[model samples]
Target: MSVAAADPDFATRLNAFDLAALVYEDGIAIDRLMVDFARGLAEAGRRVGGIAQLPPGPATEPGQVDLIDLMTGDIRPLKQRLGPGAASCTLDGSALAAASTGIRRAVAAQVDLVVISKFSKQEIAGGGFRAEFAAAVEAGLPVLTSVKRSQIGGWLAFTGGLGTLLDGRMDILVDWWAETERRRAKTRHRHVS
Candidate 1:
């Protein structure tokens, strides 16, 4: 609001241009939002330190990581709040490889609950419904999209809450990926030694 209006330049960016009008004129759906979220994450690579809030699961020890990466917010605290089927892993099999690989794998594996708090509503706005919806329908899983639109700016005029309502059920493969990644890392370390 008022802050943007105070800045004539911002006013032009919003009203003088058609960006704001287009988003409001046309209501937003779910699919498009997912696509946009993915794109942003790619662009934001290595920046979002990832929320280390670790959703509950079998207790596992932490690992040695690059001091720089940890300091740079490249590694956020693990996410908390585990569901009946939730699990967490360091995404490292051994002491070497980074954690992101395992995280991605887990997401693709179809676990009941994948807790990736890195995404927002706008990112997926451009993504179509059928593609994302199909996954949920097929797996019978639910998607709990989390976002913080309160302080966001620019052409992304989002409408709705931080989360989305996806019909049908689905699964998150987080546990599988975590297990695989940990195993791989350990195997690699043993081979090296």
Candidate 2:
């Protein structure tokens, strides 16, 4: 995967941001990073929600992709077979919509973090997890997702430049989480006062 060059001010930006995207060229490494981040949070007893994807298989066959629901451990297939002669994308839109339920559930449950797999072409075009992303952000949950470098403009427009851009590093992710928790605590304390 094409990881964004590590930004020196990433940690600083994390302190003031709740929405961020790991910008990458390809998806394999980005996927791994997201999974690890969620796993670490779950191990730390933090409530993590949303979906992580298992990349499609070999190039010779039709792609078979599955999305894992972080909160419930459910796997949802994200591709459909459109026949060998079809040159168009085989992504199953219905399956994607169904999988998005996890995001809605996460918002309702008020999870500590929401890890959406990727904000790619579909999301850029106003589909995929766009609404789910909006929901999690609206709920004031810290959100982490990946985006193709080619789609950075779309991501920026969608987030209105309010989201932090992070490299595909576990340490950076950890730093962001710590800062987010600190911010959340401050918000809670202010409300209590």
Query: What is the number of residue pairs that collide in model 2?
Result: 0
Q: TM-score for all predictions?
A: 0.23, 0.83
Q: After superposition, how far is residue 162 of candidate 2 from its true place, in Å?
A: 0.9
Could you tell me how far off, in angstroms, the CA of residue 98 lies in candidate 2 after the best superposition? 1.9
lDDT of each: 0.30, 0.79
Q: Report the C-alpha lDDT of model 2 over 87-172, residue by residue, as the tens digit.
A: 88778887787678988898899999888999888787877788888777766778889888888998877765668998778888
Deviating ranges (above 4 Å) for candidate 1: 1-99, 120-141, 151-193
Which lDDT tens digits does candidate 1 get at residues 53-110?
Answer: 2222345333322211221235433323344464775423331123343333333554
Error of 2 at 147 (Å): 1.0
Q: Tell me the alpha-carbon RMSD of every candidate.
A: 19.1, 6.6
